[model samples]
Structures are given as C-alpha cells and as structure tokens.
Target: MGKNQSSKIFSPELSCTARIFTLTPHFTQADHAIAGLAINHPQLVATSSARELGRHSDVSEASVIRFVQKLEYESLKDFRDALKKELVNSQTAGNSSVSTQPNTPTEALAQVVALCSQALQMLTTAIDIEELGRAADALEKSTCIHFFAAGGSIRVAQHAAFKLLRLGYPAYAQSEPFSQIAQASIVQSGSVAFGISFTGSTKSVVDALAAAKENGAIVICLTNFAGTQVTELSDIRLITPAPGGILAANSAQTRVAQFAILDALLTLITPRCEYVEK
Candidate 1:
C-alpha cells in the first residue's frame, strides 16, 4: 500500500474495525467474518495468521484473503502490518486508559459530570473565534440553509435547523438520504449546507455535502476531525475533539460540544439576520 493510504488505515480518528463497521452495509459474508474478528479480537487479528483468523471467524482462508483485499489491503501481510502498527500506536497513546468504573449510580453520575465538564473545557480551549465568525458570515449571506446528517447526528442537525428557522432563516434538516441529496442538488448560489458527522466519515453526509458544493452552495462541516473525507468537501469547518474509548463515536461529550458550537454560531448570526422583518 502507498504511504498515505497506510497512514489513513492506521489513523487514530477511526480504528480499522470501526472503519469496516462504518461501511458494513456493503460487506459480504467474508467481510463480516473478518470485521467481527477485528472488532472483538483486534490483537488476535494483528498477531495471528490468515488461516487462524479464518478458522476463528468460521470462514475459509481464501475468504480471509478476500476480506483484507476488500478493505483495500494489498495482501494479508499488508493488512497484518497495518493492524500491528495501529495496535502499537493506540497502546502508546493510552487509548484504553481510563479510571476504574464507579461502584454506584451516584459515583457514575459524578464521573459523567466530570467528563462532560472536561469535554466542554476542551471545547472552549480549542475553538477558534475567527473560524466561528467566518461560519456566521457564510450563514448570514446564504439565501437558504440545509443541514445534513445521519444516525445519531441527525438530532443535532434537526435542533440547529429549528433554531435557524425560528430566527427567520430559510432552513431545513432532512434525515432521509434521498431527501438530503435532493435538497443538496437543488441548493443555489448563496445557499449554505451544514454537514454534521461526529466521525466525519458518514458517506451519506459527505456525498450530500459534495453535491451541494458542486451545485454552487457553500458547504460547512461540523465534525470531530479536520482531515476526514467529510471535511475535505467543506468550505468551512467547525471541529470538536473526539472523545476517546470504545464508545467514543457515540459519546455525549462530543454531542455537547457540537451543541455548544451550534449555539455559538447561531448567536453570532442572529444579529446579522433581519429576524424582525420576517
């Protein structure tokens, strides 16, 4: 594999297993078998041979080979090499490091509060005023606004859309893939499209944003990472730090950060909008 491709496969933003799961709808039986192993026993997949993996996953050795190939690996050896590197990197970064679980509900609630506070603090430290201003400027100038998201992020998109609507902006948030793509395709110049994906890897949101950009709409992305495919298609980016761990992608911390960003952006745009006229 090329250096850049290998780097992406080992990126900390998304584990190899998470990447596979994200694209699981297109997977076959063999792909499912390998992906299952990657998710449940990543260390085993990194250390074991293709034959061993096939046996454990209840698939043929040939199927094992095909599975790696389907993930864009050049060969079984290449896949193992990347897996090993990712495992090492994750270990070094202490991705699995966390305090012991709370023994009681009260303790757990306290821990949750602590984590949320830290996440919001991090958000405040990382936010760039200039970028938020730029985003607000884009929104203020747009004739219409479309919010695109899927899965858990659709809630955030819908919330933002409602806030903008109440402020008299022409805004919409569509959860269905077909409706999102249709709206993106028809958005005219001076329109703004906001794509929300915590991992910034959701194909539907990425494609819809790309479609909007192609049709002359300004595209903005609210994602956890800047280098992801979804961000690549955006004209402006509002980024939040990823909450680390197995449930990182679904963390409430990230959701809180997204809401905070949305609130700030809306506050900035409210003064620019002629809400009284509407």
Candidate 2:
C-alpha cells in the first residue's frame, strides 16, 4: 500500500481534524463512517475493541483496522489511545463542542466562548512566532497585499485586507474568483498574496495563491491545517487551532480563531509599518 498522503503523524497537542480533512472524499465508506463517529462521538470508538467498532460502524473488523491503518496509526491500541487523549484534552481545555449534540442557549453560549478561548490559547503554541516574523518581514517589503479566500473564509480575507489597509499597506481583496485570479496574475516580486482557508483546501483560494506564487508574489496562508494545497503554496504559514470537532468546520467559533490569528499577525506587522523608511 502507498503511504498516506495526508499528514498522519499526530501532533499530540493538535486536533486530529487536520489530517482527516486532507485524507477525505477518497476515504472508503467504512473509513468515512469510522472517522465520523470517532470525531463527533469518540465514546463510540475510543473505548471499543476493534470488533466492537466494526459492528458499531457496520463494517468488518478487518475494515476497522484498515481505517486506522490508513490514518497510519501504529495499531488499533495506538489510535484509540490518541483519540482518547485528544478527547480528554479538548474536554479539559473547555473546547467542548462535539458537533453531535444539542445544547440549551445558555450552554451553547458558554460552549462557544470556551471554544474560542481554547482556540486562542492553542494559537500561542500552534503558531510559530519565528515563521510569523517571516510573514511580517514579507509584508514590510511588499508594495501591496492581495487577499484571497472563498465561502465563509471570504469574510476573514476581507477583515485581513481592511486591517492591512488601516496599517497603510495598499491591500486588496477580490470576492469574485475571476478578479482574484486576474489580480494575482499581474502581481510581481513586490507584492504579497495572503490566503485564508480554514480547511486549507479551498480550490479558488488555492488557485489564486498558486498564481500569486507563480508570479513571484510572496504567498502567505492562514489555515487550520498543514500539508494542504493552500499551505503548500504559501511562503509563510500561519496556523490556528481547528475549532470544534468534525462537521463544524464553518462554525462561528472557527471564524473567532481565524480573526484572532489575523489580529495577531497585524499586531506584529503594525509596528513595522509605522516606521516608514523614507
């Protein structure tokens, strides 16, 4: 069998979502079912024996082993242990959204606030300040900044552009795909192209950033996962924690994390822009 193309080496502190996201739609039906239950309902998998999980997911026991192996886990025991640990950490950190449950409004509010806080706290470790410095350095030299994103991430891109504009960089965001690609096409060495994709797999944003990179613009990506197309195209990668469990990728909590990531980057870029080398 070929090696798993997705990032399978778990970062103990990182949410397992990133690897799973990149391994997607290509997954076998058995694999998909297993992954879904594991994420949104870990109690169904983390504690089950391989055969029990097989019955639970309506697949064969061998299929159960194959699913975990596809994620490149060392063994069923290792996979379950890692999943259990992730669930515990998430619960202890107050990141308590499982995507499979209903909550009262009060409980929901608390859950969201806690999730956002957890995301921010994870950011301190998930992000590499030195790599972030590289992004700031790119912004300092680029004559203009172009932001690219699609769907829910469009708002995030717009927010970033506005922030940079306030900081006095000639920043632009094209909501339309055509305009984005066209703008990227004309960018040259003195430009910066910023991409925002929570899953790090949005095709339009990836295309725009690829064009930007091809044309010599510095490409920087804000994403929740590594080793995705968006990150592959980026010269600088800014990672934030993936908010919530599976199937909640577009939840408002994700935007909170994303917005925080941009604010952090802006904070670093802000001071540099003020000096204005005349």
Please tell me which predicted candidate would have the highest TM-score against the true structure: 2
Q: Estimate each model's TM-score.
A: 0.63, 0.68
Q: Model 2: per-residue lDDT, tens digit, 114-170?
A: 767766665665566677788888887789899999888888888888777767888
Kindly list the per-residue Cα lDDT of model 1 for residues 1-278, writing each as its tens digit: 25366544334444454445334435676676677567546678988898899899899998898777666676888788877776665444333344466788987776666656655755654555567789999998889999999988899999989888878888999989999999888988889999999777899998899899998999898887545688678888777655353346666776888899998988788543465323
* lDDT (C-alpha) at residue 164 in model 2: 79
lDDT of each: 0.75, 0.75
Q: What is residue 233's positional error in candidate 2, in angstroms?
A: 1.4
Output the worst ten-in-a-row residue range by lDDT, candidate 2.
93-102
Off by over 4 Å in 1: 1-99, 271-278
What's the distance in Å from true for residue 71, model 1? Answer: 33
Candidate 1 Cα deviation (angstroms), residue 245:
5.6
lDDT of 2: 0.75
